[model samples]
Target chain A: MTEQGTTSTALRESITAGLRQAVKRRFGAAADIDAVEFTSLGGSNRTVLFDLVDGTARRRLVFRQETIIPANSPFLDPARQFRVLSLLYPEGLPLPEPIFEFDDEDSLARAYVVAFVEGETVPRRLLDAPRYERARQRFCAQAGEFLGRLHALDPAPAAFLAEVPDSIDPLATTMARIDRWGGVHPALELAARWLERHRPTSTRRCLLHGDFRTGNMLLDEEGMRAVLDWECAHLGAPAEDLGWLCLRSFRFGHVDRPVGGFGPREPFYAAYASASGHPVDPEEVRWWEIFGFIRWAHYNVMQAYGHQTGARRSAAFAACGRNIALIEYELLMTLAGHYH
Target chain B: MTQDAPSIDELLVTVREFVQEITPQLDGRDRYHAQCAVYLLDIVRRELGADGTDATAEQAMLARYLGDGAAGAAGLAALAAEIRSGRLDARSDELLADLTRQVVGKVRITRPDQLHPMHRESRPAE
Candidate 1:
């Protein structure tokens, strides 16, 4: 993690300050905002849980606001993110309840408000190391099931299509993004090019949890409470989720394990297939896997620059920039018929 | 060294070292590319461990499949371009399979087991 000072308390004060203004603006005069606690900080924004706890008042509620600009800055679009998520998931998927969101940049620079979801997202406990091992498979299965539910969502074209920009092919947009970073490593040129050639197209489109992985989902002792981070959410083929979950990079260290080092590909695919009633498509899986590798390499390049500029510095980010080479090698092998 | 050779992990270490030293002095995006070089090393290393093969065997497999001439076919980039162009399909499936086995052995590192053991997942299982 970047050594950005945890001015989180101070930031919490700032958010409380902001929320007090919001409450006064909306409720005018008698807004009894009780408390705000700084709960989480991540690569994108500062999150503070604002509690309007008037226990007897039927409106006991909490919301999240993106306050601080964490290192590389988060890709979340507070407005589009909440709107599309609400449309696609519609309370079916485990996700945040968006009471209100603002994209007017001026509101808080890079700010958003979401319902405070109380859960632990430190997946290592749920995957590898103990104390949570008994809950591992079930937890992993729940994460998969949530994503399965996500992939199973039909945004009904009109609402979903309206949210994403009119000018971009979701898959192509993703490929273009990967390509934008293609200039990074010569080692990856071949893989990047290979990914370009093999990019998959899925007409059976659905709302894709573009960044679905262990850390992206929020979990608790019971299981996944919510799948957070809709920053990269998009409309695409379901296989993208499959490929992303299985990508080796997400495995962290247990390279032997797929699905973010949580479990095997079959069970994940089985869970998704069962949810969607669509059997897994390995070709599509390969296509999406290639895309996943492409995405990984691209992001590594992006983060490498982040490390260099000293915007963010971490073993993983540094390791991430270095990780693209491995992604490249995988790409070349894939192109050379490695997985064929 | 045994016939298995330096191992992918060892090779990766070399690449990582290269990344550390070579990353500087390059300006603009090339600096980013350097990061990828480092990452590729890790990927190769992982695959080497996963596949239990060395560069020599991989090279030999490629050359044999290409009928003693494949490695020189304009580097990996050109080879990839050729593959994309479908020009390389001129080679027989046996030769193709040999080249494929080499590549497959490496890339399949991410998979948990030998479902097909030779081919990419054509479609998900029943």
Candidate 2:
């Protein structure tokens, strides 16, 4: 059967009842579950928007729950995400505040709730909407500065973050992940070999926001309000984030601007260098961009396999198999020095 | 010799019409899935149209690249393993050219739109 959003009628009712009891127990007062809307983000977690009412006090919260859906990253545990948020939110970084985490027997799922950051997370709207015109103009430089600060954080103190494995050799790890899937596209295979051979040496390693791109960021009338989706966070070369941001898939046809379709790469790199006190290497970033496309292609192929094998079935997942060709074409162009 | 009553093109045209009729009726997640369904059908139709030529050309290219009768995915996997283990040079002009040809062929079938404008204007020689 077609997978609807995480909440069916029965599940919704049960969740609301359970949530009411939990909230009451925590707050020492009765709180009504006004409404619950389950929004599927096509990840391992189910995004739930729920309203809690206590007299005039009403709070709209985002409750994330682990689904049966296979996670894209090995490091997507919500407990780890809560730990990351605990550090970032206090530093005045624009992120959802981690409210509470629940894993008790009475709780419906392994879930955590956070105060929702209001904005449009859709890539197209963030890119094209006139309301976001001002936001788009300032986003690239802001993103660069933000990332520089993130990468400069003292990772020594964050022992919990270390639980997510450090990818000492990202190229080898990425290649292994692709090989494990056991599907061969000759272009992908060749690209992998090229990347492996030409792997750059990175001097300093820091926390990399594994999926830093336009779509993962939240935009509003003002500008980029908050960075969302921290599932892929890990300790690696900071170039990982920069390269991922410039990937063709993340750019959404704004090929000219390598930084989130906002503006030129020069300004972004300039800001990052100024803030981080580290020199930005375009070559290193380009290498990661190529790696991003390869990783994304492998992901699409795996998604298609998931559909075919009946591990998970969806029309969208089935269509992902065809998307590998487009990604492969981009990979060839990038390798041939045709695509930027 | 007589063909089947519903030709492949005829079946695709009917499917297109059905999709156009049904898609507007769907909303929210269902509408999204309907769009994916339409796209999948279109890809299938394109694949069916070019199946013979692409398969034959790909097999021949694969055999030539591997320098043996080994062709298709299994052959490519073995070649990839060799490259991974440092036996084969991935940076060689021969391997790059062959891989480009293979990739270009795939783009023609699955995403002709992504091909460079110059290449798209002039379809690759058979």
Candidate 3:
């Protein structure tokens, strides 16, 4: 066999053996794994889907493992993410059920298993697919309701999340990342100054799905199935999540539908207000939306830096460097009140 | 110095077409990377086609605010520092307009289609 082919085969064998060990330990010795498929979904994590068969019963599960973590990455480590999932799974949130976390005995380090939720997570498909038309109609209300419930969850149990820089001060955290990445972006600096000056006064801190947006959600024709990607979960202002969902970049060409390219802001805010019994503050949300743009730009810059420095070479990352221009344009337009 | 028959722009177009032609055969991650490649090629083409006028104008605009010797990457860093320090707060309106023009120039190269209709129309004709 060719050297590359031989190496891949050996790698696959090791993964299968590691998973077999995990399955046997969790589901008894009789249980075995079948059809392990690697999913290229997350940028900074490796996700594998597989079927664990115990006698006649078969269960589909996801094996999510941490990949190369960039220095000063904003995302939580796998252990912390799993902890967050375990803490929130019983809170009636629409999230995947956490199974078992990988231990030292398992060959796979920094990984965990969860019950696989079936739904589409791609933003393009969720936004444009004809099959998702009904889902799109119901998405805003569902998102608002979900966010309301998520934000209202008791923050005491997730106290560990407070260590996240975003939980302390999201704007400052993003600016720090930008600076570390050698981002000399004047547009982002301008946005940061604006954010600092017009900072929201509300001190209501709650558990936030720090990367709350359309792409991170799993949806079907009925509506949202589960909220995935908990790596960014933190304790922060509820409006932060609300604004993140309304980011212009997340609108995906459906600029008219301000809320995740699904519907207008009023219905979403109304749903949240109805659910949480807290009146939606448009001004605060607007501040967060501007902050969201800066945060998004920082992420892009970080990815581009990774590509440039050879930490993780990817065409997608290279594209991110160029995409910053579009993001900057939109951010400036939003700041100038030229875009709604 | 004379260049080859296939200019940089021509080569970019040919490679982009090749990527598109092979894109159908690829799936999943490869296809996504191919799409990104096409996007990067387009950006490069637009950047190459652009005259140096926008960049020169941007430098001049920055010099107006930061005085002479403020140009290029150093000028941008200085502008950002000034903005961060609130030294440019009084001139925010003018600064925002100039920054918008600069970002608009960038967007024109990277993804002009994303620009608002007003901004698109305001872009100087090539």
Go through the candidates in order and give each one's DockQ.
0.06, 0.64, 0.66
* lDDT (CA) per prediction: 0.58, 0.77, 0.88
Interface RMSD of each: 10.1, 1.8, 2.7
Best TM-score among the predictions, by candidate number: 3
Highest DockQ scorer:
3
Highest lDDT model number: 3
lDDT of each residue in B37-124, candidate 1, tens digit only: 5655555566556533434555565454345655532444344444545554455344344444444444455332422433555322
What clash pairs does model 3 have? none
- Cα lDDT for residue A215, candidate 3: 88
Better of 1 and 2 by lDDT: 2
Q: How many backbone clashes does candidate 3 have?
A: 0
Off by over 4 Å in 3: A1-7, B123-126
Reference-based TM-score of each model: 0.65, 0.94, 0.96
Taking all chains together, the TM-score of candidate 3 against the true structure is 0.96
Q: Tens-digit lDDT track for model 1 on A89-108? A: 56467787666554453345
lDDT of 3 by residue, B1-126 (tens): 889789888999999999999999987778888999999899999999997878887888888888988988889999999999998888888888888988988888899888778877665442
